[model samples]
Target: MIPAMPKPLTSLLTLLLIAMAPAEKLRSETTTDWPSFRGPGARGVAEGSTIPTTWNADPESETNDGMLWETKVPGLGHSSPVVVGDRIFLLTAVPDEGETELNIAAGGNIDAAKDSGAYKWMVLCYDADTGKELWRQTAHHGEPKATRHSKATHANTSVCVDGDRVVACFGSEGLYCYDLDGKLIWERDLGVIDVSKYDIGWGYASSPAIHDGKVAVIGDDPDHPFVTVLQLTDGEEVWRSDRSEVCERSWGSPLIHEVDGVTQMIVNGFPWIVSYDFATGEELWRLEGGGDNPIPTPFVSHGWIYITNAHGGKAPIYVVRPDARGTIKLDSEEDSDSLVWSVERGGSYMSTPVVSGDYLYLGNSNGVVRCFHAKTGEKVFQKRLGKDAGVIASLLAVNGNVICASENGTVYVLKTGPEFEVLAENPMGEPCFATPAVADGVLFIRTTKRLVAISEPE
Candidate 1:
């Protein structure tokens, strides 16, 4: 080694190196972890992927198109699979009599399971590569204190994984935190959250979103509606903002978007589409018009935030700028002062719309798929999916195709563009309601019976 530099020269070099460094290093998200509800930022866009056009659940096949492994999950829940490095995490509720079938369209009017038994709220882990299960941890074991919607399970909320702990919210049951090795870290009980607007019991289904080392969850029940954030490292309340008493129940999940230089958490709710400071729970802006029950999560893309909900008195798609403030209530769809564009009609119901480049894809509750210009809201094409296939899960745009799945477990792959083309209709042969998670060249699909990992052969 050469002799050390002069003290003044060394100091100058150190300063130069420090200045060259980025002020804040952005996280390079890899295919290893699916940290949240819709996978990374809930964008529903898998990066650099060539997803299979056709897949089969049957392992024994003469052809090479299906699931790599089909591992039967024990319980019934609609929570999507959250994948981490080498492992996939999901939650389920195992009732005593094994209630398997549910019709989400029934809302809260359907009859509950006859003589329902104590439920088992479980946290399960599986090997990502092969569908081999890794571990199962019991988050809660008791009779469900609060009755869920007839079409819902006790574990409608999905589990979220931070770097250190995986969080699972069982609505009225409790919120649980577990280490990667199935050890209990912490748990919080937020009481019975009966999220019914019309005095009908539609259980809570909002998954927790983790941002800036804090997990934000919404309790949009008619009884107690509030937005609460907890420390990710340790289960401590960072902030809790009480929502308006007039706000009806909302099933949409909270999402955290880092726009420009500011970070804001956007929440979808009735009577208001609210944005809050990610660090503190201070309200940033509130838009006052949405459906009576907001089920679609807010989406952020292309430097614009999109919020929309249908099946209410007002159905409007508000594309707002990141630099918004106070009240953003628009009088009509022609309000260009605050909104970039507003689609007054043809919004999503249960499915959260996804943006693939310049096009916006909407999959309705009745298996109807439509595409429109994202900025102009001009209709491109509207088509129904496979026979008797009604879509409930949100559509995903992956590898130049839109993946639209129906409750009948058929995934319709459509070519993305102004022209309408049905690419393929792959059958899962099981009941499905959750959106499939795509990462690491594998599609993790959760059905009513099992968690299947599908990938093309080498």
Candidate 2:
């Protein structure tokens, strides 16, 4: 028989045990997970109020004053770095220098570079705290038969990650899904890409978007012109939407947003800004007049959808509403009830626009950054960011500054206001086409040769 315990002793023990139990972490909207192309919910707005208005005093010192960690990445890709909890993921291609076998089955050509061998697709994972490489997943290695512009790379598309898996699409090579530990789960070959028209442009750059338990991709190949949805678990084809005309291939990623209370995936491709019901791949509305090769991802806000086409002959910013779904005519100048407004002047051809406080900001390929009134389509301000052109990366707003990264490796930080005030110009010393990702007060920047992490000194 055990001796009876004292009431006071037992009660104290219970209280101590309860207090020792681990507390559940609170979910934060301000401290967000930069999950997709822009950020959580596909909205570019970051939650915190203490965003750095001025660049940290010292960028090079490792002092905890602001910068957390900065590290060098393996290869080159225009794809931006995606951040999850403690890990940041980036996709790149390692160019082989000599005698590489050609994987012609993937699509297109197999020309071996006499000097540089073949380009191999690689996905990199880095530690957010220390900037250490966690693991590297090499998807494929072979001589790319197809040729892309000198500015493009094999791994130009950004990678998307969910809970335990990371997904990346290497055009012509295939779509690959890997576990957090670098284990290959599944792969789907989209076949070799035909780039004969655009001078054999680089494979494909449209990043995949996950919505409603499905991974959706717009595989607008000339041969198989369709927008397909696949099961996120096993990579099985769920449904494919067929279009009458073979849509021209573009590097723009599809945007998923709710318009007038209905969830829609708005895509700006060759000929139109087509809206599809997110539940089913059914075309809901189409706005035909746009630029020739629409590459920038479309953004939506305040019930109106904004879209732009870059070098496309008739570049225009189309304001569309889903209310006029089936009744509006495409070429009517009588103000189709669906199209609220269309502005052709001062629109971006390559970079996507950033919306903030009733204003929209955009940077063209020529390094000119402009702001427009979101509702009235009024031009607010336009200024040149860098002396040379090529502002392909999208604009990002965090804290109170509007950030734009140039291809030449300069990041211009300006206050988000009516007048353009250059706060600070930060350089990574390498060329970059990837956008910046801000998390936990640190900024993740991917240049052609390395991935750098900057933060305010503690």
Candidate 3:
């Protein structure tokens, strides 16, 4: 039996105004197409789209209500799909036709996957409207230089698009640039980026960011951790900053934004969070103390930059002003001159938080979701989505609903408000580790086996 449709939020007009006003002013509006990770500016909020509240995505089901189409993507990948215009692009690593597996569950196992002999790092493009394979290019083919976690993948980073060019970073493999038609323009070898934890190989997952014709990538390895910016046109090195002194290791991506005529890139890390000038790679501001194993990317919303991380008994949320300078080490939750407000706890470990209306939504790997006041550090409400359900993908806010996908293959649509209310719970019928992407009116979900597109029935 099909589930009933979820009720829409009551404050639609207020949310539309509040979410779109600051988004438009900052030039990070989540429009019809999602360009990068968590959409533009990593806000994870989409507008002018209709996302289905319920769906049966199981291919063999007799009646597939909200399922538009599903296609089998080769091999394993945790990279989320990125949509630009009518094209969708992603990356995957295919072993040499051997038995490979990904443990899609909630556990405390800190072991690496068995070494697959050789892998083909591939770049695939598809027609967004029909889920048709437009083209596929082999970026590289060889044995992996670094090991991956049992729950992770070799293709862990999502691809970013700028105009007609798309960039993919395969960690230790290399960074490849390609045209929209599967033509390789250039590639760069950034050395061996072995992202580990406590001397254990856990793999790399930091994605790339594009802004003002420059591509930025962060490699937080045990040794020689750095942030490098290259020209998007020809892959020319603009500047690279050494981050070894500030952070030991990080898996979070870089966030680029323009504030008061200054372009700055912010990165989330443990023990310290830093911001650098985008043009010259000079240090602009730094914040001391955060979660240990940082994974969530920093994003801007409500005229302030929001950064969060978890692990090592410290889960903090820091809201900083865009025009901040120098170093800041928080001693309390009070509002500093540069940092608007901070909280010592209540941050997600893997899932990135999303802001909509006057509330900010966050979820941890345990499927415990919380809502907080966006401007001030006040807790609104906390509720568990489901027992035994785990969330690794980030949250998505669209059409007045917060989309939370669990590793147990369920997507919960919660209404946006201060009170706790779950409008709908839809199952994807497959494990999901990557975040969902929305474009035009279709919702793209990269499950463990296939890429499923959901939309309202005609």
The candidate maximizing TM-score is: 3
- What lDDT, from 0 to 1, does candidate 1 have? 0.79
Candidate 1 lDDT, 316-348, residue by residue in tens:
677888788778757754345667777677778
lDDT of each: 0.79, 0.71, 0.88
Ranking by TM-score: 3, 1, 2
* Candidate scoring better on TM-score of 1 and 3: 3
Per-residue alpha-carbon lDDT of model 3 for 1-458, expressed as tens digits?
97754455546766677777864343334346688989877889887678788888866667778988889999999899999877889899999868568876738888898876999999999888789999999998999999999989999899999878999999899999999898999999999999898677789899999999999999999788899999999999999999889988889899999978999999998767999999999999999866889999999998899999998888888899998888876764442778888888999898999997888999888889988899888999878889657889999989988898779888888999888888987777788888999987899999888898999988
Q: TM-score for every candidate vs. truth?
A: 0.89, 0.85, 0.92
Q: What is the lDDT of candidate 3?
A: 0.88
Which is the better candidate, 1 or 3, if ranked by lDDT?
3
* Candidate achieving the largest lDDT: 3
Q: After superposition, how far is residue 302 of candidate 1 from its true place, in Å?
A: 0.6
Report the C-alpha displacement of residue 284, candidate 2, in angstroms.
Answer: 0.6
TM-score of 2: 0.85
Q: Which ten residues in a row have the lowest lDDT in candidate 1?
A: 23-32
Q: In candidate 2, residue 431 scores what lDDT?
A: 56
